[model samples]
Target: MLTKTVHSSTDAYTNFTRKEWASLAYQASVSLTDEERTQLQGINETVSPDEVEEIYVPLTELLYMHTKHSVNLHNDQNRFFHRETKKVPFVIGIAGSVSVGKSTTARLIQALISRWPNHPKVDLVTTDGFLYPNHVLEERGLMKRKGFPESYDIRKLIRFLSDIKSGRKSTEAPMYSHLTYDVLKERTQHVEEPDVVIVEGINVLQVNKKDRRISPVFVSDFFDFSIYVDAEEENIIKWYVDRFKVLQNTAFQDPNSFFHRYRHLSKSEAEDVALSIWKTINGVNLEKNIRPTRHRADLILTKGEGHRVEQVEVKKS
Candidate 1:
């Protein structure tokens, strides 16, 4: 595989400015409606039709090509072996720091890619389900390190991915509730073998296999493609704080909300708490864990102020 940086010698990626990338959207085959976009938008984030047309449409087209190539590769191998096997799911991994909008990215990608005519069954899941239950985190005294890699059940996450990649007809994953801020006991999401499976999380692209002690296998080992959402650290801090403020008025206000106590905080008090969480937890995790995985991604979306992707960088195949 050849590699080259566009118009640059030092960078590893072929950089594409927003407009240059948007030009390729003339080939966009999926047609999304405004209501669908609204459903996919994240809290305290902006995702406009222009952003989808310019960024995601072309990105989806790329994923479709990859999926097709994978199917053909399997067919070719089977011909040589004189045996047939079922088609495996084409997995996509999405990773980024919290509040960077990776969730929105995953949802938008799933919606767009499922519109493809050939194999439209696309299922999306997040690694949050693989996080250790709140009780376990508390027992281990890891409550403050909630989103850190060590907080997840890596073995279970790998098992789930293995089943999907192996073309299992049906698999079940535990579901987590934000209101309860914990994994549900009796609730599970069923996943049927699909043409594409999207796994999104903060530490999704972390190079976990380098340390064998970490896990025998990584969840990303099965990914056909990976994307990393990126933004300046300060910008993410601001977004996180802003999102906290919004949740205070909504989810946090519910009496049953895990954070209900925070709902009545004065505006100044809320800002203080938000900043504390960012500086002590999220910011530290980003610097020590999530940000280190950025270069591992095949494609990177660099978001600017207002969460609009200002530039894209793609690794050469």
Candidate 2:
């Protein structure tokens, strides 16, 4: 049985020491490879393969089990939905603060889970594709809050996810351009039937919206499993500033980049801009939206000062 202890008054939620959490994760069903260990080293500053094995490996396994159980339940309940019919894809949601490495976690899980023999066909999709087109956001004067929940076409995104979960033979999601920070009008990426689908974004689990009727169909309803990567707000701010500086020196230098002008700023100036954006936009979104949903997640990976997952919290079913 999994064991947990309450850590503090501020966070009464049950927490597991990293080692205990890692062991439980293995019980849930993930395998780690040496190649993945090598790859993880390059992205994570101080994390080791042992850490991944203990944390992410078990998390992925739990997700695979959840997916398998969901598919079985669906097939058994609806006799007509047999193996011949496409199996409903297992939908997983990853949510976290900006620059907290939620995207990296999603990508890593996608790669890891796909290697599982039982789930060979895995596809990863980001909620970035669901964001309103730049023109639309600009017209609505909401361009600055691009990652805010309101910036998304929630209705269309719900419909798209519903279609995929219904086992549609094929579906398409709008493609968004990171370089230009806009939706590509004429392009869409087709999603074939897959064993798993990962949906990653900053606010993948938020249920509160002004549209009360559609709010009932919140994104969390579509997830078979969900993960929330967590860290101190201050740490996330530091990460955002550091990553912004890196991008400003590289990607933002591109003429076609939407943030190209930021490349001209001095290091201190760039840091100020990054911190300002984080404080005004991403930070507000986290406080008002994302962080509250942490309790709703099936699993939570709590990070330390270095962004290494130091503890984990798994909800008891």
The number of the candidate with the highest TM-score is 1
Candidate 1's residue-wise lDDT over 1-317, tens digit each?
21221322227788889999989776654657888988899998768888888999999988888988998999999999998998888899999999999999999999988777774788899999899999999999999999988888887888888889878899988788999899889999999868888999997887664346765566768899999899887788789889999999999999989999999999899999999998899988988888878888889999889989999889888
Lowest summed lDDT window (length 10), candidate 1: 1-10
Per-candidate local distance difference test? 0.87, 0.79
Please give the RMSD to the true structure for each candidate, in Å.
Answer: 4.5, 4.9
How close to the true structure is residue 102 of candidate 1, measured as C-alpha lDDT? 94
State the displacement of the C-alpha of residue 238, model 2, in Å, after optimal TM-score superposition: 0.9
Report the lDDT tens digits of candidate 2 across residue range 27-114.
Answer: 4444556666556442334446666677778777777778778878777867864445556888889998888888778867877787
Residue 140 displacement (Å), model 2? 1.1
Residue pairs in collision within model 1: none
- Pick out the ten consecutive residues of candidate 2 with the lowest summed lDDT: 1-10
Clash totals in order: 0, 3
Alpha-carbon deviation at 34 in model 1, angstroms: 1.4
Candidate 1: C-alpha RMSD after superposition = 4.5
Question: Candidate 2 local accuracy as lDDT?
Answer: 0.79
Clashing pairs in 2: 22-54, 25-58, 29-61
